[model samples]
Target: MKTITVKRLTEAFQLEVLAGADRMDRVISRPRTHRPGLEFVGYFDFFPMERVQVLGRKEINYLLTLTVEERLLHIGNVVKYHPPCFIVTSGQQEIPYLTLFCDQEGIPLLRTSETTTEFIAKLDGYLLKALAPELSIHGVCVNVSGIGILLRGKSGIGKSETAHTLIRRGHRFVADDIVVLKKLGPSTLLGTHNVTAREFLALRSVGLINVVRQYGRRAFQDETRIVLDIELSPWQENALNNELEVIPQFTEYLGVQIPHIEIQLQPGRDVAGLIEAAANNWYLKQHGYSAVDEFMKRVEDGMQQ
Candidate 1:
């Protein structure tokens, strides 16, 4: 997680602190203050966690109107219980006890003349960097029904051409060449295309072109989840000999397991149709139906007979 410091904010905004210069060195995040004086409570809520709190000058005055006991409680909650990075925006207002307590606790107190809006705008990008979701790239992601399908394969295989055919078949596009994968949460993999490279899919003979304009909006998708992984390769005599064979299951992506499938593509095969089959099969599997498994069971019964 990246942190933006007071010095950096000052430099970015070209603003000076009216008070609490000693606190200017504090590193913090963009903390939202619900009300004046309660800003202290918000800071206290995160207690001891390394988070920065920013408050407008008017919010400070609102706190000053509170009873001394209320103010003390806020201070006590933060100073004694929860300590965090504190910042006051639109400076020159003073809270004597707050400053004293901050000094005693060695907590950083910062002030800036910049309005809360301006201050937040400056910290917005940094905050985004800190909050960005993690990503992993193990499977190939294809855009199908606005879903990101990851097609895994060895080099020299026609993954890009298959994707191109899918695009021509009225499916949207995401990443054609390389898909960027990010982990959104537990057991979930997010696949997205590089923004600059998203609109174009590279073929062996033809170069890149904007899929959106060439094939229309239906030819491209914004992004999709990596629900299925189709592994493409030349058909080999020793590779997956049985049409009814059940390959080993893969349930993880970048160490976090997930639902996966491997589809082998060979010469003179309908790759786009196979991809559509994969997508539909995934949907059926999600709903507790496996057409291949059912056929296998029937075949086993017939063999017994």
Candidate 2:
């Protein structure tokens, strides 16, 4: 199971440790956070122990309504679950015995300056991205007219060269040589440069070049949502003709299906321009304008006449 430590969350969220610093190594397996208001009221039937427990304003106010003895009893019951950590939002100081109970039980008590709603939203977003399923593919990713295009092919097939050409044509580079992909949601795949390969590209005779330094900041992008996949293959006599007959090809990655196109690589072909056109065509298709569909409709109308 994937897990994040309380210490990692603390660093990521810039949380201050109010108590239980020794238990910062506590593991949180769930990407979701929980507010145990019901558990605070002695309802523990379905409390999620593996999640980070958030003590928001509502829960803190409820605790204030209880007598000291009643407060300790409810706090004890909740802490006994050994939650990954307790985060008090809105920079609220600890309730009467909160720090004591957390310290005694070795449960990390974290405090963040952000309000309850803001902290929860930020934490949820962070955890979702931290735990998202990720994979790396050997390819070049670029943004052509705001559409993310992933170009894949065998080694030395000019992926970087094509990317360089596109960069010169005012396109933005996401990654070269290796593209790291993460599934943000059911239908979205986010692509970024591999950490070790960021801002760098390898090309024949040119060696290693820093894209940001060579092409300026506008030519490099931190990440983009991948919308299309294009696989470059060495030119075959009949492949180009066959590709024209195919419509709406798709490839599956990380449980998501993305539009896929295959192009033949040959000497003297404007591959970069082709990639740019592919991106424009994808944008048009998204808006219900398909060249193939329009042509087919025209042919049907002619036949009917």
Candidate 3:
């Protein structure tokens, strides 16, 4: 499980720390936050200790109705679980029960300017992206005709060269050598350039090249959802033969399967054009059409006639 620190979250959201400044190094393992509305009402049986608790206007307003000792008892019962932190939203002025116990219990008590709903939504998005399962693979990721494709094979298999050609033909480049694949949802794998080598393409012929400097901004994308994987291998006369593949293939990454294809490379072959065709074909398949299946149907009908 990926974990983020309380200090980083505070810095990212510019949270005003009312207590537990020394415990800012505490780690948050969960990606979601809890409101603790029930816990505030004397229901601590099922309190979540590890989550970041949020005190919105509703919770704070309810706290106003109780006496100071009752407030302390209620908040204290909830704080004994030792939550990662508490975030008070909606621009609230004070919650002494929270501040006093949070400091004593070594919990980070913070405040945000955004409303409860808005802050929760933003925090969810940030946490989803930051805590997503990540993997780095050796390949070239490019956006050909708006279809994100991954070119994979052994080293020096011309992945970069093919991506260079595709970019020259107006396609957008995503990542060159190492592609970072982040699984945000259950079945979605997003591809992007390596952090250290962002937007830089390495070609064997001319060394390292900056994509934006060479091909302008339109020819590059910050990230793309990988929809297809293409494996390129050197063609051998004995091992290679023309084959009609009607059934679609797939490649798995982080448990998500994506459409896949294998193309053999040889001298005088238009690999970039082939990749473009594959992207168009995949787009057609997405729209309930398959040229290969249609061709086989036509052949069967002719044979029967």
- In terms of TM-score, the best-performing candidate is 2
Q: Give the TM-score of candidate 1.
A: 0.62
> Pairing residues by index, what is the TM-score of model 3?
0.88
Regions more than 4 Å wrong, model 3:
44-46, 238-244, 296-305
Q: In lDDT terms, which candidate is top? A: 3
Q: Using lDDT as the measure, name the better of candidate 1 and candidate 3.
A: 3
Please give the CA lDDT of all the candidate structures: 0.65, 0.89, 0.90
**lDDT by residue for model 2 over 15-131, one digit each (tens)?**
999899998998877778999999988887898898899989999999999989999999999999889899999888756499999989999999988999888998987887777
TM-score on alpha carbons, each prediction: 0.62, 0.91, 0.88
Distance (Å) between predicted and true CA of 304, model 3? 8.9
List, in order, the clash count of every candidate structure: 17, 0, 0
Between prediction 1 and prediction 3, the one with superior TM-score is 3
Point out the worst 10-residue segment of candidate 3 by lDDT.
239-248
lDDT of 1 by residue, 20-108 (tens): 46655666443332223444655445333454556677657766777998877766665553334456776656667667767666665
